[model samples]
Target: MAVVVGSYSFLFVSTFVAALTYITYQLLSSYLHKWFAMKPVPGPEGTYLFLGDALMFKPKAGEFFRQIVEFTQEFRDLPLFKIWVGPVPFVALFHAETVEKILSNPVHLDKSFAYKFLHPWLGTGLLTSTGQKWRQRRKILTPTFHFSILTDFLLVMNEQAEILVEKLEKKAGKGSFNCFSDVTLCALDIICETAMGKKIHAQSDSESEYVKSVYRMSDIVSLRQRRPWFWPDFIYYYFGQGKEHDSTLKVLHSFTQKVIQERSESMSYGETGSDTNQGQKKRQAFLDMLLKTTDEDGNRLSHQDIQEEVDTFMFEGHDTTAAAMN
Candidate 1:
């Protein structure tokens, strides 16, 4: 009886293990086959659900962008091509008309939900904002970037550029150096001085905590956008129970708050010399425009709003130029 009982137990365990394996295989196979079965609009055919291609798509970094350009060229005649970034669906367009339609109707399509990762940093500012709030903010800020205003800011830009050149000449006496790093520092300094009215010598002090934090956060935010599943509100808000995200937020907030505080103090002291109408006309920087503007209810901007905008510009102005330089 003991021998029979032991044999029965072993048989039962084996049966259970086999059943579990079958179920797992079926589930994985079903999903994988479904993903594999997606039709690629025909032009230049390539592997659709291959593991290599899926791995290539996830980070969507420089290499992924290059892959996209190459894929577009190979599939130029295809209307819509499907690529899998892991299990996620990535639809690509190779036609001008379809791309134009999407761009023209931003209200209908809107930014991808993946962009929610930016909410912690940008806080619905122009770059990350959508729908009616975006429309209104765009209208208000459009004039600030107008050709006339940009032309005026050239003087400020040239002054900053001169300082950057002076620093580079000092460093590159006769040895070859990395132009990429040098230009990025130059751009950062110019944007900080011109955008926030703060002189951050990013060229001389590459180790500045604020500057380093900005770069780190920018790269992380871009990574987060590519992985939508990881950006649920609760997880990002809690930062998965770690202090890294919290510490980065503190650094960013401190830097922005300092800029706003100094600007507010300067305005209060009447250092702008804009007491008279004519004096006000002479001042045309972003800060001056922000101070003069009012919200929808004719109420002025709150300190928080001003800080958000300042942070938005600082991140956008520098990172964009840096990417372009690279």
Candidate 2:
């Protein structure tokens, strides 16, 4: 009986070891092949089997975006180069021709895998959505931004610009207190009024929870992008950055959801069998337009869809205006 038990345990242990060895060998072999393939591209030679160029990435959140630009400068002679972060390959093209060749193709319209990082906050909105869903949403929303619609927004722009100038006037001689901040606040105010028809007064209330959460979320995203170790959702969450991220998302999404809920309650214009605003000639808010709008197939956006687009608009517009100002 003792001999029988020993033989059974030995067989089980051997089988497990053999399976593990085979799997490890297969993974290493595939990685070696991929590494060899990337060698043809002009990039840092003799890349490590695992870490790749991840160790070279800037540790600071602000400089995370500059890594690609620095690579371009360092490898100026190469029109195209590969940046390996861990086992992932980031192929960068410098020449306009190479970029246009890929970008100009409709089949390559899908956002890269990295954009999935934004999915938790942005959802499948236009900024991150792909395939048929993106096609349908884009078709529906594109007309909303026509020249005529833009012309209508000029009034909101002028109003916000005036407020921005006034704010700057107060700090005219304060000795360089980050004027970039003034621009961001003004941009936030403009987006809120123009898009949601609500005045968040972000210029004055910079310390608001929603505002802080937005900035925090932005920082967390940059940190996650550069640190490949944080790329896996399971590991990220296990370490609690994911929880922190979710907390920020909750704050940000609450604001958007509140805006959506209020907009829905106030107007029945887009919804079937709902009363329209008392026939007033008020300028349309972007949210109002989207609320009462439909696609070519008579499909109105779902509640979640509206929230995603609104949040995306807020995120995209706020950061862009700040970057431009700086």
Candidate 2: worst-modelled 10 consecutive residues by lDDT: 268-277
For each candidate, the alpha-carbon lDDT, in order, equals 0.69, 0.81
Question: What are the per-residue Cα lDDT tens digits for candidate 1 across 212-299?
Answer: 8887777677665554444565765565422566588789888878767767788778765122235434434576567667877897
- For model 1, the local distance difference test gives 0.69
| Residue ranges of candidate 2 with Cα displaced over 4 Å | 1-30, 44-47, 172-178, 269-280
Q: Which pairs, if any, clash in model 1?
A: none
Q: What are the runs in model 1 whose C-alpha is more than 4 Å off?
A: 1-54, 57-60, 67-70, 73-88, 92-98, 163-178, 232-242, 273-284
TM-score of each: 0.71, 0.83
